[model samples]
Target: MSELTLAIDQSTQGTKILLVRQDGTIAYKITKNHQQIINPQGWISHDLTEIAANLKFLIRKALSHAGDAAIKAVTISNQRETAAAWSRRTSAPLALAIVWQDNRTTKVTEQPNIKKREKIIKYKTGLPLSPYFTASKFNWLQTYEPAVQTALSTGDLCLGTIDSWLLYLLSEGTYKTEPSNACRTQLMNIETCEWDPELCEIFGINPKNLPTIVDSDSNFGTTTLFGTLEKPIPITSILGDSQSALLAENCLHPGEIKVTFGTGSSIMMNTGQKLLRTKNGLNTSVAWKRKGKTTYALEGNVNYSGALISWLKDRLKLINDPAETDEMAQAASKNDTTFLIPAFSGMAAPYNKPELKAALVGMTPLTGRNEIVCAALDAIIYQINDIISLMCQVFTDSKLTLHVDGGMIANQYLMQRLADIVQCKVLISPIQELSGVGTSLNGMNNQTLTLSVSKTYKPCLDKIQSQNQVKIWANNIKQLTK
Candidate 1:
């Protein structure tokens, strides 16, 4: 292996490629923004052409800074649930990539054919039945897109998540996805480590179109098409962005937990091997598979976080941008009873309701933008508490420190409230790019930098009052959605 290693993290928002020395030192890093769509029907999709176009420019710039560095391996970390299908002949995507946020699959997923399939699917994949998974999205593409239907009938279509598409482009023909990526499709059996025939029969997708499932640490192939580089490096590791972040955090032991606060907020706790089914909306999934043994996790996903702050800026015009919210937050306090439960795109995890609506409760005439802003921030943390309470049942000991990362973790008010409501130490990492850099690389394996606690917020609220207020907020949100 050469002293230099290249790692690319392709997420929902953008793609970042990093050049790291064998000493775990970052030589250089470059990122490129890809175009995303909130379509006419309000479905989120990624323009595959736009992403593909941006990659060339981004990679060229990243390598130019490498100078004479000898590259060893090229690993990938990607958004797990985003789906893309293409023709094997032209190797062009048939339609826009169905982003994980897209809700187009709700109709088909609830259909009789797919409805009964959820239980069976969960049994194998360790993922609940939802439009967020690839099974439903793949069905939607086939029914709506003529190009996809043609490819399916003629056997020209190849369906895969974002990682598969990237690996195909990088390898030129070697198309396979690691266990971390494959498990998200809701088609692969976690126990067998293979795509299930019965599961494919339920979704009406051909088994032939799916990518081959491999280990996370296994060598995928060579990046031959990346021609600007001096030598083609081996495609070494492919881990799901979330799982990779978990590994990068050095959460190799079971019972270790981390929360990622991004466009959405998710809390995942590492559970070694034992796949206990979640009863209170917590989803049990494969954290990562190594040496033929799979590590399981209890995941609690909350659909809205920073996006609420984004919504206030874009829809309400209360603030000019997301950055301005922090200043506004500083002026606001919890003295008012105002509560904003943002179920904008419905709620996930503990309150998995599709018809739920966003609400701003207990508002008075004296209410201002900053007050509303405070309530909104409080509501997001309250949601996290709801999931955390449910997550606590899995672990016998209630006393645990939460490791936090993501764009939203930067909000001081949100972090404080998160600690207060959960009654736990909320440790926020300085590097918000935990998802990108954490995936496929080790932060503690050979790295000198410590995953030290950047800031720790302790609980400072009355426990009873916080619990009562949270219940009231939940009830108010229930009414709004109804």
Candidate 2:
């Protein structure tokens, strides 16, 4: 019988379950989107119960078509930094999962105590003292949510990212998290790969409430998915979604890079074994840890990328579907100079301004739906180009080529525009769901699996034109910030 690995990618938007064959191809795939719960106060959240139920639904739906293939292992890749708190005794969630995009803890992060320790926190965690990470969200829950408070008082609080929550659910109470997810929490020390007590104290999170840190390829435990499968299978691997995409793109060597254009964009360059801290706005994080060896990466995050398209579709009603963006952008007037800065959740990386709101500039009477759509697409490309330029400064010796994946890459116009603006070759992954594939590859221990690029986008604009475009974007950004 053939062997298969069930890989689950629980991301910001939805949960995807894939039955991956030994050769790294998906045998069966199913995805179910959960509700994006936004409170009246504008705090974004995820119903953990809904997400867990969706995962169960996808698993059962995918496995029904597995035929007689032996299900060998289960792996997970999840949205990093989304915080969750639950009961250690009852295994019930204490509160809704606070999204990484939610900035409800901004006030907490700006407190006199936390502000004074910003440098120390960044030094220890390799991340800025911002509410964008898991630590502040955990703190917010502990302080504001009544159930979380009650759980904490009774010592029943289990604080973790989405991976640990799902791991606890699937592995029957194994409270564990891997480095890729842990590093983003602003609680783990990047050097030691353990929860730093000082950093934890700074965020008012007890180290004991956190999950056990483990290697990315560790066998977390076995799960039968609450009897969804015929037998219990070992849960073998876990990684944050961006790091998983890095592994899927074969960016194992120093200076290699991958860009994941998901709900948000993460531009990560593998720094190999060395942990390099940056004075610039870029974040240094553990790419993954395996076999007692840890790999580090420099990451620049864009708070809005594909989410911009969703906004345009769902809110503005400019486009009925995300796929329509390509054709609409292509049809837009060439002379239109409208630019959009999608800082809806505030800008990240190079300019970590959570205070700035989004803007649309340089609009003319000629600007219409097509032009606005084009601008929105260009906004995503410009944000990515900003990070790519920064990475170029850090790795000056290497020529950067972005190995790209995620739903947004399907937009041909956007990919070409990214190539033109960044003035580099862009390679698109054949598989849209690389996070799941990467986790499955790690679970199977298949180092020799070849990754095939389905398409390549080369720079079409001349050097001068590309430079001018970048300058225009920079100017717009300066105006927004000013």
Candidate 3:
């Protein structure tokens, strides 16, 4: 019998279950999307029960195809910074999970106390004071939801990111989270890799209520998928989804980069063991911790990337399916000067203008749906280009290689545009289950895992054209901000 690993990726849009073989190849996969619960106030949330149920369904579906006997170990890569509070007694969620993109906690950062400590918070956490992290989300719950406050006061609260929630459930109440996820909570000290007491106090979070921090490759305990497995399997690996994708791309060396284009795009550059704090709005995060050693990354997050396409489909009814976007963009008139700023929730990193709203500029009589779609694609590339420029400023290493993945990579035009704007080679991996492949590889690192590239895009646009486009986009952004 062959040894196979089950990797679960719980993301904002859905839950994906992957079956990975011993040699880093994905054999089978299943994806299930849960509802995005949004209130009239525009706060985003998820039902913990629904997500947990989806995981079971996916695991059962995969086991039916691959057989339960073939699986030996389980690994996880989950959405980061989405937090929730649950009871320690019955394990029921006190409230809906506060998604990473939720802007409900925007007021939390504006408090006089929090604003005064922004510098100290950033110095320790390597993250900007924003509602997009876990700490603010947890604080929001405590202030508004009576049940959350009750649980916290009674010592029955388990407050953490989605990974910690899933870990607690999978381990039958272990209440643990790995560094990659914990670092994003804005509560962990970047250098020490431990929860900062001062940060917790500032955010009104108790250290005892948070999950115990563990290494990414540590033994997370055993599970049978709620009694689906014939015998219990060990859960050996856990990572934030973006970090897992970086690991999957095999970006272990400093200056190696990977960009995951999902609901939001996370662009990360491996900075090896040393921490390089950035003044350019890029985040310094723990890439992973293993065997008591740590590797760090400089990351820039875009709150809207692939989610823009979702908005076009669901909200604007521009297209019936996302796959049609590539064709529509290609059909757009080249002379059309339409451009879109996809700051749907808020712009993050480099341009941390959370108060600035989204804008679509340069529309004229010739503008059509296809032109708007094309502009949306261009906006995604431009947002990435902004991060690329920041990376160049911080690390002058000319050998930076970028590896790309996720659902958006299927569009060849976007890939080529990204290459042109950045003026570098963009390599796309053929691996379908990228995060799963990464976590599995990290857990089983003794084997020599090889990374193969399926496509490489080179810059075709000249310097003048690239600069002009960027200038025009910047001018439009300035107009909107004004």
| Model 3, span 124-196: residue lDDT tens | 9999999889898988898999999999889999899988888788778888888899999999998888999
| Candidate 3 TM-score to native | 0.98
- Give the Å shift of residue 302 in candidate 3: 1.1
Indicate the residue-level lDDT of 117 in model 2: 97
Winner on TM-score between 1 and 3 is 3
- The local lDDT score (0 to 100) that residue 32 gets in candidate 1 is 83
Quantify all predictions' global Cα lDDT against the true fold. Answer: 0.77, 0.90, 0.88
lDDT of 1 by residue, 1-482 (tens): 34666778887878888876665447788888776688677788998888887777778887778877767678788888888998877779999999887767888779897787677877787777888788888988999999999999998998999988988888887778877778878888877778999888888888899988887767788884468755677877778878877776666667777888776777788887777776677777788766667888778777677667777887799989777766787787557778887766667767777556666778888789999877777777888888778878877643477888887877787788888888888888866666555543632232333577789999888889778877887788667756
Report the number of clashing residue pairs per model. Answer: 0, 0, 0
lDDT of 2 by residue, 1-482 (tens): 99999999999999999999888888999888899898787788999989878888888888888999988899999999899999999789999999999888889889899899999988988888888998889989999999999999999999999999999999879999999999999999999999999999988999999999999999999999879777798999999999998998888889998989999999999988878888888899999998889999989998878888889999899999999999999999999999998877778888898878888899999999999999998988888888878877876655589899998888889999989998889999988899999988877774534777899999999989999988999999998888
The pairs that clash in candidate 1 are none
lDDT of 1 at 168: 86
| Worst 10 contiguous positions by lDDT, candidate 1 | 440-449
- Pairs that collide in candidate 3 are none
Best by lDDT: 2
